[model samples]
Structure formats: C-alpha cells, structure tokens
Target: MNSEAAIRAAQNQWKHRGAQRPAFALPTQPGQESVWDYPRPPALLSDTRTVQVRAKGNTAPIANSVRALRVLETAAPPTWYIPKQDIDMQRLVELKGQSSFCEWKGAATYWAISNASAQPVAWSYEKPRSEFAALQGHICFYPSRVECYVNDERVRPQPSEFYGGWVTDEVIGPFKGDPGTSHW
Candidate 1:
C-alpha cells in the first residue's frame, strides 16, 4: 500500500481503538494547559482569536486572520492555519519541493514568502481531505521562522521542524519533536 493508504489505515485503527491518550494532562488550570487533552488523528476547530505572522524584521504582519483554524493533536501543540485571504499573496512564493501527506488532511506543499524574508517557512494544503475541508487554501506558518501571535500572545515553535505546532505559554508539554520523544 502507498504511504497515504497506510496512514489512513493507521488513522482508522487509532480512531476506533481507545488508546494514545496521555496519562498526564498537566491539569487544565487557568493560564496553563497540557497537550494530552488534544485528540489523536487530530481535529480542526475554528478560532476567533486574531492570528498574525510577521515577516522577520518587519513591524507589520505579513499574514493576519481572525478566522483561522487550529489543528489539535494528541502529544502535540496546536497548529494555527491562516486563510489565504488573510495573507498578502504578493509576498508569497510557492516553491517546488517534496510535499507531505497528513492522514487527516491529505497533501501539503511547502511555501516561502517573497522579499527574501524566509524560505520554506510555511506550508499549505490547497485541497485537503474532506475531514479538513475548511483548511483548503489556507497556510500554516512556522512560529520558529516568523513571529506568530495568537490573541496577543507570541508563540513558540513546536520543538522540531517537522510538526508545525505552535507553543504558547498556556500549552505545556514534553511535546512531540523534542529530544527523546520519538516514541511518542
């Protein structure tokens, strides 16, 4: 089977089985959160909070949207996806690179903004799977590359380059992509 097929089968298997839930969710207290509460196979939710991504050294945001979507997955921090309409498309240049496939979201392409701001600092799924249809034509930025903010709180990039989860002060984790978290 192809990678996509394998991923779907795994997703279906995990979806039905009651497992992968973190034992410790760090008590979802006021001003604090844990990644354990997030779901496996991930789920998308509409975010009313303002999301902004400022190009490096730029005072103004190159991308900003109030109607963004957040992908919540178990063991990972939330990834904020901004709508295409919210970004300055003129400053974006889609580069050719090997794309990635998400079990839930289908295929995603790499992206970089123009003006020599950054290279491959973001990605987008132009036509996502039905489960994430809302994300079509939307791009999710890497907090590590650009200054990303959600509702006035600056975000920290998820530990590594692969998973694009945004880490805020509220979300606490020995999050995925960190050293020795490969088993997770």
Candidate 2:
C-alpha cells in the first residue's frame, strides 16, 4: 500500500475513539480534565495560559507565549504549539530530512537547539492538513528534552519517546504512549 493508504489504515485501527472514558481511565476532580474525554481526530483549541520552554539548565526561555494552541487528542496529554513569533528562532536549527507523519495532522519538521546536541528537541507542522491549518507556523517541544511550563507549573513528559504530549496537573490519564498501549 502507498504511505497515505497505510496511514488511513493505521488511523482506522485505533480502538478508542474518545467518545467515553475507558474503564482504566482515572477520574478527574474539579478543574481537571480526563484525556479520555478529549475527541478523536483531535481538537485544536486556543490557550491563553502562559507557556514557556527553556533549554535544560537554562533559566531563560527559548520560547514563551500566552497565545498558544493546544492539541487535545484522546488518551494523550495536551500538546502545546507555540506560535513561531514567540520562539527565539535564532536558537533553533531545523534538522533537514528528519520528518514524521501524523495521521490527524500531516508531516512534521524536526528541530534542534543550535548550541546544544544534535538530537531533536522540537517539531512543527509547516503544512498541516486543512483541519489543522492553524498549526502552521507553530512549534511543539519535547518536554523530555527541555524544560516546559504551563502557567508557571512545570510539565512532565508524556510516557513515551514517540509522543510529545505534556502532562500537567489539570490533565488526568492512563495516557496513550504508555507501555502496552500501542493499539490505542
């Protein structure tokens, strides 16, 4: 099959469509949200909360913004996409030829910090699918590789290296990307 057809087949194989929380999902308290309650194909929502990204051991943020876009998909923590304008572009170097495909979004271009190691620390969808057009010109960081904060609260990296979701106090989950959840 062609890549597009393979992606379509992979998309259809997901067992959880986000319509309801699974039996193993954690219950949310007031002011909290269950990732399971998020929708399939995801939702792109504007966020006004302060989002900040800093290099490891660096006090200054390389990217900071209150005008972020949050991508909320089922069984995963929310991924924050900062506007390109808010990022210090001079400090980032795009890793050419390193890319990935997302069934819901499209192709992603990876990036690394210029003075840091060559490992990718962030990614962006330069040309997202029509449904996720707002994501263009925005970038998302890997919390595992950098310090990330949401409204001043530090974030935890989602459980797997394959996913870049940011876990925070307000979001609860038996999140996708955890062990044995490849089928999610």
Candidate 3:
C-alpha cells in the first residue's frame, strides 16, 4: 500500500472501544455558556504578548534539539513552543529559515539552531498567537534533527515520527511500532 493508505489504515486501528469524548460546547447548566462553554471571552486574555525559552541541560549538539528549545514549561524536556520575545534573541541565528502553516495555528518560521558551546539544534516560532501562544516559551524537537539527551545520557527517539517532547514520559499505547505488532 502507499504510505498514505498505510497511514490511514494504521490510524483506523488505533480507535478505542471505550472512550468518552467531551462535548464541544454543550450547556453545563441551565445558564452556563461562554468561551467557558463555547460562549465567548474577551478577544485578548492577557496583557503580556511575549515569552521566552532556554535550553535546559547540555543538549546543544543537534539542530533539532535547539529547535526544540523553543518549548516552554516549568518542567524539563518542555515542549518547544518558544515565543519570539521569550527566546534569547542575541543567540539566535536566523538562516534562510523555512515557513509552514498549521490549520489551527498560523504561519511558522523555522530558525537555524545556535548555541554557545556547541552547534545549532533546531528552529522555532516567533509570533504564535491564536490560543497556541500559550505554547510560548515551549519547544518541540525534531526527532530527525537532534541527538536526544535524557538525564545527561543520549537517548534515541522512536523512529518514523517527527515531533516530540523530550521530557514527557507518558506511555501512549500499543502503537504501530510497538512490540508484537502485526500487519495493518
């Protein structure tokens, strides 16, 4: 099968038999309805428009890692979503960065990674508003771009994927590549 077909079939197999999906904007009570319920809120929630990101630990060898440095979280291996203002602007080296658009978010600008003691790691977004700006200060790493370091030890990411949060240890499922896997 073609890659797209294979992916579709693989996705179909992941459906759960018992899962309660949340209703998008159903009424919680007789009178509750707002952005809280799909009602609405002020256009802007916060006055702060910018956030920053920094590389934790010593993961500066790979470009993807630096790109992942855009992640913002109080915890480590934060998802890379660094806002333009949150990043250390002086250290960044904006190459002929590429751009892409997400259906939910807006345009994304990629940056060539740069570090003080090592080579570049990855790219990041600068102005990512539209709800996702909350992802500001966070970074998402390219599995293909960097040498992942978990607790000071280099850890190889699972193959056939691109995005990852270097720190989240949540076990997803008996995914496609999981052991004892069968044909799609």
Candidate 4:
C-alpha cells in the first residue's frame, strides 16, 4: 500500500482500539500559556527567536536558528518550524518512504540528525500549501526524539505521538498528547 494508505490504516486502527484516555496533571502558573487561548483551525505566527534542537542523548545542539515560524491550535501547544537557511544542514539527513498529512500544511518529509546517536529527529514540508507557504523548506523537530530549546530555554515535548509541539514555560496545558486529550 502507498504511504497515505498505510497512514489511514494506522489511524483507523487507533480509532478502533479499545482504550480510554488517562488523567494527567494540569499544573499552570501565572504568565504561562494556556492552550485554550489558541485559535481553531490553527494560526501560523512568526516567531523571531533563537530555536535549537539537540539529539536526545547528546548535549551539543544539532540544529539551531533564529528564523522560525510557530503554529498554534486550540487544545495544543505551539510547534515551531525553523527555516532551512538557519538550520545546520550537515547534521540532518533526509529519510524516505513515509509521509504525513496535515489539513493545513500538506505532505511532510522526515529528517534524521547525525550525532553519536541520531535518528529521525525532525520533518519538513518541502512544498506547503499556499496558505502555509511560509513553512516551505522549514523543518520541525519532534521534542520526544530530540531536545528543543527556544532562546536557550529547553522545551517540553507535547503529550501525544501525533502532535509535535515544543512546550515551554510560556505555554499552558493540559496540552495535547496527554492522556484523554486525543479527542481534544
């Protein structure tokens, strides 16, 4: 089957699985961000700051840049997409044979960072939909697979496997990826 077909099959399986979402901590402090405040259908915002991603097991930064964009959606944290020019191209090797579909962004290509222990740490949309054209050639890292930092502050991975939001002190939850939030 084609990649899209495979993805659909997997999603269907996940829907059919007999599992309930679990309860999680909803700790929030003043001045932090709340996912409830984000917009629906998501909004693409310009984030001008130093963004960096390091291998999960390494201290050295594998990708870093000041030019990046952020996507904010209701019930989810922000996901940053760094420009190709500012990223360290040498460390990220492209992966093949898999793709993901986002209603707004279009298809995505995966990238693996090369460190002493590197895997597919990020993904990019070579040709984003015209509405999201700014994201073209910009890569987004998976926080669970790699450590992401914004302006030197390390980020927390979003709670779910499908959502790749880099949660920082500024953003609040209960965010997506947490137990029982899949339907959110």
Candidate number achieving the greatest lDDT relative to the actual structure: 2
Predictions in order: lDDT: 0.81, 0.93, 0.36, 0.75
Clashing pairs in 1: none
- After best superposition, candidate 1 residue 176: deviation in angstroms? 0.4
lDDT by residue for model 4 over 1-184, one digit each (tens)? 3356664553453321213222442655787766776765568999878998887677777777877899887667889998888777888788878677775567889887654344567888898767788889789999988889999998988876777888898987677676776766
Please write out the lDDT profile of model 3 over residues 5-78, one tens digit for every residue.
Answer: 55345435532222322233223344322222111111222322222223544433322222322222111122
Which one wins by TM-score: 3 or 4? 4
Model 4 gets an lDDT of 0.75
Candidates 2 and 4, the one with greater lDDT = 2
All candidates: TM-score = 0.87, 0.96, 0.40, 0.78
- Model 4: residues >4 Å from true position, as ranges? 1-30, 57-59, 115-119
Clashes in model 4: which pairs? 33-170, 33-172, 159-177, 160-177
Lowest lDDT block of 10, candidate 3: 33-42
Is 1 or 3 the stronger prediction by TM-score?
1
Rate residue 158 of model 2 by lDDT.
96
Q: Any idea what lDDT model 2 has?
A: 0.93
Error of 3 at 160 (Å): 3.5
**Which consecutive 10 residues in model 1 have the weakest lDDT in total?**
13-22
Task: State which candidate, 2 or 3, has the greater TM-score.
Answer: 2
Give the winner by TM-score: 2
